[model samples]
Target: MLEAQSRHGRTVLTTLCVLALLACNRPPEIQHDAVFGPSHGAVGDTLWFSARALDPDGDSVGVRVAWGADDTSGWTGFDVPGKLESLSYVWHDDGYRIVTAQARDIRGALSNWSLGRGVSIGVAPVRPEPPIGPGYVQLDREYAFRAVSRDTSGHERRLRYVFDWGRGKLDTAAVSYPSGDTVIHRHTWRTPGTYEVRVKAITDRVGIPSAWSEPRRVLVDSALGSLIWQYVLGAEVHSSPALDEERGLLYVGCDDFRLYAVTTAGGPVWQFVTSGRVRTTPAVAPDGAVVFGSDDETLYCVGPDGLLRWRHGLADKPGPAPALGPGGAVAIGDESGRIHVRAPDAGEWRSYRTGGRVRCGPAFGADGTVYAGSDDRLLYALTPACSLLWSYPATGRIRGSPAIGAGGTVHFGCDDGAFYAVAPDGGFRWRYKAGGDINCSPAIGADGTVYVGSDDRWFYALDSSGRVRWRFKSDGRIKSSPALGDNGEILFGADGGSFCVLNGWGDLMWDYDAGNDIQTGPVVGSDSTVYLAGTDGRLHALRTGCRLATDAPWPMYRHDARRSARAGGPH
Candidate 1:
């Protein structure tokens, strides 16, 4: 009985030993080079890596991936042994990094790490520099902006740019450019307001975006008329004002026998005294010279500093403002029925005698051909050399200056109460008769709409074909020419000191009573300020919050704020 009991105990001990051996866990095993992932990546990139492992006891296993010493993915969900497990990790820094992986079984036993995979993490492009562009722009005008950036990854990569136009608008380039290259983009603002523009760069391949650049603030004006300030001169300002945009100065002739140079801000800069009434509008040359005709029977040229540069004597008192042509040529008409023209860099004055006094400023065609009106009832086209090109006879004397429109059509009003459109080659396009003499020059709009004023006290808007579109009645006879605002608003003055603003549909926007007749038309500045000359002896600067319609061929009297009298150029 003792021997049998001893054998049973040995058997039980042996069974217990076998059960303990079975319960002991063996850690999951991974191949020495089983970890795999991309060899290169950019910062902030989410990279995937796969690792395979096997458990000796056929237990489920989980994988853990470490992108760096500080970045790690905690254990993943358990899966079957010998399965390839994929885990994702993001690197915040740039440089060479080693990725590693390990495995664990359900029994909580960890295995040795697999061979590390070498990944060369790249850096994204640097933030772009602040956009470079104009500080002030007219509303609805397209402007250009530039952005630049560089990549520090030491790799030849392309970068794309994105622009934020501050108006909750964003634009991305259609294609990428080389790193450190400048990217140009254009944007237009429809509304008037201050806007901040910003930009950013991104790697084209990895799509890693850099920080945004510093913002550039831009001011946009509506350019519609509101009173900013008014400067009263010594006498009536029948002469239109000229703007020297580069110097921020305005030059205008006053009946007080003085040529005034005022700042655009309404402060008096300087005034040049004349011997006779200075009734002609001033013209600015590219070299910062101001030229105008005075009843003193002299055409004077003054420097930007208000000093007289030179003066040329005329046959008789100059009746209208001088027109500046290409290369500093000056053309003016005198009461002696002579049109005097001086060539650039020449000392001699060339003259062409008309049958009657030349009372209006001459307009220039694209090729430098000059168009002038005479009291003899003729519209004469002359060459820059003062030789007649062609003459279109009118029923009565032509008093107003002529305006050139698209396709070289010349528009002018007649003392016989008729408005005519003459073709470029001296052929008549059409004629529209008014109830009274049409004495104001025509302003051509972008769509070929012609705006003019008549002695009948009416402001007329006609289509390109000389058909009346609409007409607005004024308090007195209309004589002042029309100027166009950027938003298609028309501005004109009349005999009763009335300056009115009208929209494209002929509805009145507003009006200002200058207390005296406004014979000269209004001039618009880049900031949309309107400079109106009134017989009240004041130059009114109205902040219309509207810009000039640069697209219009003839937006104002004598062409532009400088009274250039040249066609096919910027307003």
Candidate 2:
């Protein structure tokens, strides 16, 4: 029994030895490799760090990562041998950040941290320069606007520029790294006015804006000179004035039975007396002589100095102004249904009789064909020799003179409230029906759109197909013809005593009050000044520049009698 008990004790001892050996061989321990990453980066830059770890017993492992800048990511677990663990952290301030990592075994045994990777985050200090402006820029002209920025932290970076044009326009510009702090931009103003501009700088990386620069006032002046002066006459001036741009002279007839030659400065150059009211706009001869008809049934010619040159008695009162034909021949229409052709010496060349009263001036075609509209509802295409080429019958009395288009299309309006586009050979191209009697003539625009006003108190723009493109309504009947401005603007006066300016799309741009009915159309000067006459006997000059009809001299009625073609304004 003692031998058996000893043997049982030895067996138990052997079992204890086996359990101790198993306890000594515990779960795998983990070892970490050196940590590595970039040393420095800008603030807000993401820093990436990498570390290598392994489990000694080839067991699954977990890693804890810590960024010394008060940032940490939770533990991550992995089972692969010699696996790399990576973590990225963004720095928000300027400071040194150390990244360290430790490994843990499946048995919860943890190793010391690996070598730390140090990263320095920096913020570049900056000062913004004040924005500079041209101070005085001409309207419609592009000028340079500039701003600058300085980096005081000795670090290179990209920057963004924001410019406030003060005209309800904001602009942004960017400069890449290695570019100078100074930046230049360009802008233009559409109208003559005063504005203020400012600018600021922002970091492209962080989108942080610096202080705005000081404000700069910019003065924009009209490229077209402003209103110099105005001249008031004795009676209402219904006559559309003529401008002699070379001589800076302006001529107009008045209801007081007088003709006056005024300088562009609004001073009277000369005055002539007529026996009756001068309703006709005067035509300037090649020799600078003025020829016009009067209600006294007399066609008078006066020198540029306002001296009487000659006078011819007509059978009836002349309704339409005279037109100058090739070789200085003057064509005048009287209510007697006769177109009296006079030579430069004031001698009659021919008097062609029509079926109806001739009430409109003549417009010549490119082929020298004379066009005249009559109360008999006919538009006669006559040769310069007083022979009729063809007569196109209209729906109503053709009181408005014809305007020649670029493609030889003749555009005119009649009392029947229809605007007609007749071919050069007097063939009907198209007809546009308006809301009222078409008393004023039609003006051809640069885009081949026909502009005309009707007694129905509406202004219309018609395409070549006679389709209405756009229309604007006025308060009163529009008897005054519309004029083109240098900037694609439409100018006309309404019987309601309102002169309105419309943009290319028939949008109202501006307006003025004349206090009295405006029977005469406005004329634009070379410098973009608008000259308008009113029944109040006062002529007003306003600075409203346009880009249309710049090369035209009194485009509508009186200035150039050769043809009613208006050259487009500045492009």
**Root-mean-square deviation (CA) per prediction:** 12.9, 15.1
Please list the residue runs of candidate 2 whose C-alpha ends up more than 4 Å from where it truly belongs after superposition.
Answer: 1-168, 171-228, 343-348, 547-555, 558-571
Local accuracy of candidate 1 as per-residue lDDT tens digits, 1-571: 1122254454355656656665797888885556887876768878888998789899899989887867878998888887888888777877777888899988788898878888777787898888876555557666677788988777757998999999789999889999888778888889888999999997775566778999988777665345689898998788888888889999989888999999999999999998999998888887889999889899999999999999999999896678888767778999999989887665468989999998988888888888899999899998888898999999878888999998889999888898899999999899999999877788999999999999998889999999999999889988898898876678899887888887675756567788799988888899778888888788889866567888998999989888889897446
Which ten contiguous residues of candidate 1 have the minimum total lDDT? 1-10
Per-candidate local distance difference test: 0.84, 0.72
Error of 2 at 53 (Å): 20
TM-score of each: 0.62, 0.63
Highest lDDT: give the candidate number: 1
Look at candidate 1 and tell me the lDDT of residue 423.
96
User: Candidate 1, residue 177: CA error in Å?
Assistant: 52
TM-score leader: 2
